[model samples]
Target chain A: MSLKPKTLVDFSFQALKANKLRSFLTMLGIIIGVASVILMIAIGQGAQAQVMSRVKALGSNVMMVLPGALGRFGAGSEGTAQSLTLEEASAVARLPYVANVAPVVRRAALVTHGANSWTTTITGTTPSITAISSTMSTVEGRFFSPADEKSAAPVAVLGQTVWQNLYPNGSDPVGTTITIKGVPFTVIGLLQSAGASMGGNNQDDFVYVPLKTAQIRLFGITFIGLMEVQAAGQKEVTPVINEVTALLHRLHGLPPGAPNDFTVRNLSQILSTAQDISGMLTLFLAGVAAISLIVGGIGIMNIMLVSVSERTREIGIRMAIGATQRDILNQFLTESIVLSLTGSFIGIVLGVGAAVAVSAFAHFPTPVSSLSIVAAVAFAIFVGVFFGYYPARRAANLNPADALSYE
Target chain B: MSAPLISCQELTKSYPLRGMEIKALNGVDLAIEDGEMTAIMGASGSGKSTLMNVIGCMDRPTGGRYLLDGVDVMSLTKDELAHLRNRKIGFVFQRYNLLPRMSALQNVLLPLVYAGVNAGRAANRALAALEMVGLAALAGNQPNQMSGGQQQRVSIARALINDPQVILADEPTGALDTVSSAEVMTILKELHQTRGVTLVIVTHEADIAAYCERMITMRDGRITGDSIIKGKRGA
Candidate 1:
């Protein structure tokens, strides 16, 4: 006869209570394993979101063509292999559907005014940078003009942070002279502070100079690092990218099917690629952490087997009183499931608590996804049912007469 | 006339010892009338316990046609046998075997729980059984908290809670003192005569067997003697 659910549950609870310490030890493994898995996934998701947000902060509908044949390794590694010249940047600017293009040349240089000296990034670009990049805007004075860029004038725009550091008294530094690598340049404008991006990079820690002055006066280099192109509209980005790729391919004289000498990537594509990699990495780590749960399940099976043997006489008594094999099986199986579910409840609370703790104390962004919580709970139930089956079967298969005789 | 409540024809039970087999019950036949209190007495290993186990439906005979209440028990499935044991048979073990962690009330309610009785009626019936055994005051006590006699009474209460047609007691007084043993024997006799329930007791003590209506003796897996108690105890 089928035993009542309430009876089986109560019996299981009482049995577990009889061996309190052993039951707790059996549940500990599952708690630790599930908690670790959840924490790792939460951290991974947090990092991915941080990266995506930083990428979005760069600009919209803007694409970069780095001067190399982008390979399987990464875009950063490709930059050392190739460098774009001003000629190539100008050639791309003439393409249709392109709203504006800025050829960027960057270098780390020591800048000094009075007795104060600081190491800061110096970027050489044109006035079109203000139009092409969403992050660039002036709060004081105005940006250098196209004529100033063409005339190779030694002019500059001080970043908000560099300006503040140099003029801590809050004096206006616009139109003041700052030495770049021992060369004097006039600061024609002041940029609004953009603070730090999600990557922890200080955005307002640089100075902008004319492309010609930076190339000829600061550091003698004919090639630029990369070029940024902004499309006229959101719909124009694909056509602009196609035109640039075709233009660069012809300029480098590459045949069809041959790899291009340069790589063009849009902002959204980079964001999604970053997301995919991080997502894959999270799953991989979560999968590894899930192994501990399996180990915990094995521990449960071991304990349950020992418990069955220890309670052989009890089983015999219950059987003598008309407990069917299925009844015994149900009771033991219910005990195991109850064990894991208890562990699961505690693990979920701990996992989320750890996630929130990390976010609060460690200054990381951790978003606790409800889907993961549900999945973890479901997995705990699955573990219980899976591991509880074997020992329960062993108990059910025992002979009542022999069990009665067991010491 | 109604058939006997229990009838076994040529019942045989054997177990393998090493390579050869040891017969525990050797083609023994027995019949038990309804409302009759019978005692099966024998030395250890003489098959009295095995006989009781078979009659209690805790084991099946290897070769026999055993009938209980005119139904073939040998033809029943394992679950059917369990149901029959729950509904038609109650067992009181020598050790009392009350789950030590449970109170007397919970222990007594066990059979009803297995019988799928609802909470309210099961609890009420368990209390009534405890009251019948005169242990209603000790119903809240665990087995360890009670004396041997009290524990035995609680087990008897458990056996009676299901209101089964047959009560099987295997050395019920074996673990008790003289006073406790006499009290248990009195309860069993009262249950038999007052309730008209069939009672089967397995014991080696002749004094305990004297309270029954009939006595059957076994020797080396075979029945050697059977006699009706014409002058029953206390009569």
Candidate 2:
């Protein structure tokens, strides 16, 4: 008997109505697949964003002096801790394109103001360091003046956390004093709370002191811990690092082409490398999630096969009632697609939910990309139609007489 | 000249059973005129059921010419046959094959829906058919809630919904009790008498065949008798 195309809709919708629970469960496969992809991409993207911001937080014109070469996840080393000394920092400041150089002497220290003591780090630097480095700024009160630096005055600048803890009642600490290891250092400034560093160090929990006072009264350092070379302009940063590297080699008495005593780190290179690595990592994660979607598509094919088997008699009846083979194919295919699309929609919602939850509780980066959602849904529908076609074709091609006899 | 509604010449239907062709119909030639209440009776495997399916457009003969309303229906495409089945034939199955999810009214309107009839007109037609079958009151009730006899009647009403040229019944009363079967046969006879619808019944029960104006008997896929039951026309 003849069959019209419209009858396909009727056949499948009726079949779905006949078994609502079974249809919904079939949809679950797509839902899980879609959710996995979205969640994976969101997490990978968030971690990528955090890394970028950390790299950006370092001043664009500043170059760090490190010792030896190391990969991105660098192997830990204690050799040549003073990669560039105070003399190298002074010479860089004297260079034609150099702006200001601050030799960084870092050490963990405990500070006390009225017995409210906090264990934090102290970064030793000259008073001009705030104007030369991206990581230094005065948020409240004043930074240490040149007069305080020349005299090697015992004055300190409090970080955001030290200020909050040592003065919880909001009293101004500019004229007051905080003691660092039984030595009295007047509070001279406060830092603008910088967030975590590229190396994952919390910048807000530390204090800054004059280079002379930190060396004389605290650690007694002549060679600075690390040298920061600030170029006069953004373009001069690379040349400044090169000039400083040359000066440092001469100071260390290292021969030409000898194993370097120090290393110069460019912020741009680090950022680009980080960006490339994170991009690859995101694709890797997304690929892992996509595996589940393939599994889901396979599930759709299996279910359709089982459904065709169970409805053989029904198909026979339809054929006898004047339905054509194409009509039968479309009916079963429509059912499979409906099931997959429903699952995809639910999974998208669940994925967004997981992203929000992770962002809130774990503070892990999770931002929903609209592109991923749309792709997942489209993929699910395609999987439905593509995989479902075979089983539907099998049903349609069956002989009506033979099918009617199927038990 | 008024054409016969169904005409078949040298009609044959065979099935491959265990590597041997089992002949269900063999070169049967016949003509069925309009507005006649007819019954075909036979023992099991006598081809009564097979002939019903072929004439009803549910199956095509392996080799024969079947002309319905002067159209070569046997050679038509599947979709065309479905259209003809919807337009020219209304079927009543022995098991009362009503979709379980639908109410009686919806069941009757099934064919009309595929016919693209508007919902309002389909409902009206469904109601009128149900009323004709004495089932108008149970329109909202599902098939499971109705008795076997009532379900069969609903199936009858459904067949009548599309206003087809013939009402085809295959052992329709075989599943019903005596009283219900009699009532169903009464409706079939009435439909033929009042609406001039051609009626065809496939049954083994002589009691049910007694209600038709003419009876044809078959044995081993061959017609053995054809006789008119006179005076039972309006009885």
Candidate 3:
């Protein structure tokens, strides 16, 4: 027996060369399935990475102390509520391991800059917030200072979006007054544009001001919403958290045996948990996409089996001309694999297109991973082998006499 | 003759239809020398096709010794038998089993493809075969685009491409018109006479069988008559 290729592309591109359209269509299923898998994972992973970096941007040592640890949706812990105050924020800052502390007080407020008025969110924070949260970058003007917080200054910092919207003209709005709920505050700084959250929320669409000023002027006084503490180093985070909890308990006048009313979260843990959530989300979506692959594989098998029956006489003729079972098997196997691989390649392109379109045009945080692309292509090929095999073997094993005699 | 190129002793083949064992061949013995053109003919269900399959090594005998050119076919492995078929035999089918997707040239080059002949040599040989059958100009056309006679000619070219020792034609002209059938028979006679290749054809028509020098007539599961006619039997 004669064997092996003497041609770059098999000169024996017999069936494929003949039924190009049929072959391409047959392969299309695998392509779509594979592309779906790759595109979904790539975009998913890309988004995951973006969210992860944003979470990490909170700083290596940043810790969040949330009041009233609530499980699931509603039902915040009553009586056990540990309300964080401006003093508590200072106490956390005073921890030996602490570097800077910022009190976060968030509220939805209507803002006005001349005739173009929009109801945007106002994030009440200390000046150190700009330095602590890695996710947000102040764009044009300087952020608030410590003196501004101590003096309870009525000055404000605008994110890129808010600055751009209120100042539609190409003019710097620093030192300009923008009223929040009829209260005038000077725009001392403009923040850098933060991209977007996975939920598609604009990270750079809020207004920032001194926490004390926000409380006294707008929301209320004394009790703060959350204490945003930044550790000097990652190693100091646990100690800082312990010290802050101790300080909160002492301030709350709670005796021993009561459940702690506050919860502290590190940046690393937050980043990992966010990644895990997105990873699980990717897997779930990919699993759904795999159903399409299975469907595609089944379609190939069905088509191939039909092809075998239709080409029974041809198989018989080949066998008569000295082609062995293995040779017949090889030919059919090659056809199926080519079909699946073709589909996989095309599908991957479509998937990537979909992902890129969603991210760039639709503004989503999508993660494109190399591993997902490779896996998708491999899986498409696998679908070909897995599904296309039985029909080929059946064709190879067909009785020559019976096949030849078949009309 | 040194050793008969084809030899068979007590060859038997049975078909299991439903619950019954239908004997397609029962204790058949035959021998064929090299450079012979033989035709086997019978009515439907007369076992002529079964004998053809057995002689072609497409099927194994239930009980018998089949020595093909001194190699015991029964002792040979499945792959070896297939190798023998590819290296030693060529085929022309009644239906002209050209792959519908391929051109006439590709159809002619099929046997050569399995033989692993490079396209250069394979194409040249395929062209030569097509030329021999006067189908050189129709090489690029698909089987469907051509006349039945042309497709059958392409099939003939396919059979001759590998330069096999034996060319087995099973009613090669069965699907062709009277003119095409005559043309196909004429080509078969020339190959046997000029190339000195052993040729075997299975047919139901006496006229088709008469194209060969020798005719073996079968009935049921036995050979009823075997004889050699002068020149070309049909002519």
Candidate 4:
């Protein structure tokens, strides 16, 4: 005679209830393991999403040509070197497959509007910067016109962060005058807010002026800082890069096989590189967390082994009454599965709660995927069955006569 | 005329202990017809408990030709033997082997659980068995809360739950006081008289053995005597 499945499960619950402390202690390992798994994955995915948003803000099918070679960490310190020129930017812009070019020269300066003053990056670029940066747009008034750039006009555009800092009263600064390094320029527009980039730099914290105005009036510098180049289409990015590289090589008079003075970095390449690093980090964290689960499984096995020996006489009594080896095995197996699944359920709740708390307090984007939850639960069951088998088998294999006679 | 309810021919059981083969049972041949109440008396290691275990289907004999209800016990697999034990043989231990965590009623219904009985009917039958043993009022109490006699009665009710043909009691009253022992013995005798259940009790106590009609004496690993007490026959 075999027991019904429902009866077996009931028996398991009763047995677990007999020793509450030991059961919870055994489940603690699993709880910690599951919680960390979910938390680590959430953090990893959040960082990845942050990187993706930064790439989106930087626009697509684009590349940046900066002075000097790319450094080990990122953009080289030689960025301030006067190597790139407006003529070189125009030359690259005329290349086939190149769509728009925005030559940029930037410097941090203290800008004042009325009594309010703020220190922010002052960027000087042509009107084509609006076409090159997909996120850049005027939220008030208008961007500086091509005619303003040609005449080196003393008109300025305020980024959202700069506008808020310089005009804390929220009054329109479109017709107001702002002084940058003691030079007065009329505020002609305000750019929409773009938040922060992957490098944690404020994207909306700059004041824009005409390229010629900054070159001739503000900084007295003749060379441009960098060039933002956009491809005609997604498929033309590589061709555009190759053409730009050749054109720059000829313009710089660099011999063939000589490393060029400028660094041409593809935006998508940086995006994929960021994604790879974060993905590896997620896997590494998960691997460490999985080890804890296995450790938890081992803890279960240890406790179950103790339980089996402790219940030898009880097992004998059941056997004498009519329970078969399979029944005994199933009873213990069910107990362990219940233990792990209960732990996992609590872990899921705790993990999700912790994710929300981190997002709320730390301002990190942590989207707990349903897939991770599913995977954690499935893995917990596997751990329960895998580690619970040996002890259950030992219990099932006991000789009834000897077991009954055991003290 | 018909085959005995339990039959044993040349049954032997041995185990290797410390590089020596120790014989627990040696070449014992016995039979008990349906409705027979018999007692086996022996000192420690006299093979009576071994014979009881063999008959209870809790242990297999190293060599034997045995039958319970005309089915060859020696040929049955482990699971089939368990099923046979559930269907035909019941066991009552000296320590009143009721699970400590379960209530008295749950203890009584243990065999029916393995017998695949439905819960509602099983509970009713368990209460009925408890009532017969006069412990129905204490059905919800765990074994630790009950007296020795009450615990033994609960175990007896457990043994009777499946309505098996034979009941094997090994030192069933060894752990009880004189009053509790008498109470247990009276219950067993009443069940045997009223239901015609075959009863096999293994005890060293002479008074306990006197409750049975037939008594068998064992020495070492073999039976020495088998006889019906004249006055106690069918008493």
lDDT of 4 at A328: 93
lDDT of each: 0.87, 0.82, 0.80, 0.90
lDDT of 4 by residue, A242-338 (tens): 9988889889999999987788888998899889988998888888988998999999999999999999999999889888999999999988898
Off by over 4 Å in 4: A65-88, A95-99, A103-226, A231-264, B231-235
> Which portions of model 1 miss their true places by more than 4 Å?
A68-97, A106-123, A130-145, A154-209, A217-225, A233-235, A247-260, B18-20, B231-235
TM-score winner between candidates 3 and 4: 4
Off by over 4 Å in 3: A1-14, A17-21, A53-60, A66-92, A102-226, A233-263, A365-367, B145-150, B176-180, B207-212, B228-235
lDDT of 4 at B89: 86
Lowest-lDDT window of 10 residues in candidate 2 chain A? A71-80
Tens digits of lDDT, candidate 3, A1-407:
44453331253256666667887777777877887887778666776786776666656588777788545753333224537777777777777878888778878888889876767888888877766777555566778888998888889888777877888895898888989989999988887777786457988889998888888898875677776788878787788878887887787777876766676766677677788898898898889888999999998998889888988988887787767788878777777877788788788778878888878987776656778888888888788888878999999898777887778
Q: Write the per-residue lDDT of candidate 2 for residues B108-131, one digit (tens) a residue.
A: 887776666777898999999999
**Which pairs of residues collide in candidate 1?**
none
User: Estimated TM-score per prediction?
Assistant: 0.86, 0.73, 0.76, 0.80
lDDT by residue for model 2 over A1-407, one digit each (tens)?
22344555565677777888877777777888899899989998998998888777676777777655453556213234655566677777898898877777878788999969898888888876777656677877888887888888998999888899999997878979889977899998888878767666777998888888888899877767776667888889878878877887787888998766567777778888889899899899988888888888888899899999998877765555445677678788888887788789999999999989999999887989999899899899899998899999999888665565468
> Per-residue lDDT for B1-235 in model 4, tens only?
7899999999999999999999999999999889888999999999999899899999999997999889998888888877887888889999989998899999898888888888899999999999999999999999899999999999999999899999999999999999999999999999998998999999999999999989999987898999897534343
Residue pairs in candidate 4 whose N, alpha carbon or C atoms collide under 3 angstroms:
none
By summed lDDT, which 10 consecutive residues of candidate 1 chain A come out lowest? A74-83
Query: In model 3 chain B, which range of ten residues has the least summed lDDT?
Result: B226-235
- Against the native chain B, what TM-score does each candidate's chain B reach? 0.97, 0.96, 0.95, 0.97
All DockQ scores: 0.54, 0.18, 0.47, 0.61
- DockQ value of candidate 4: 0.61
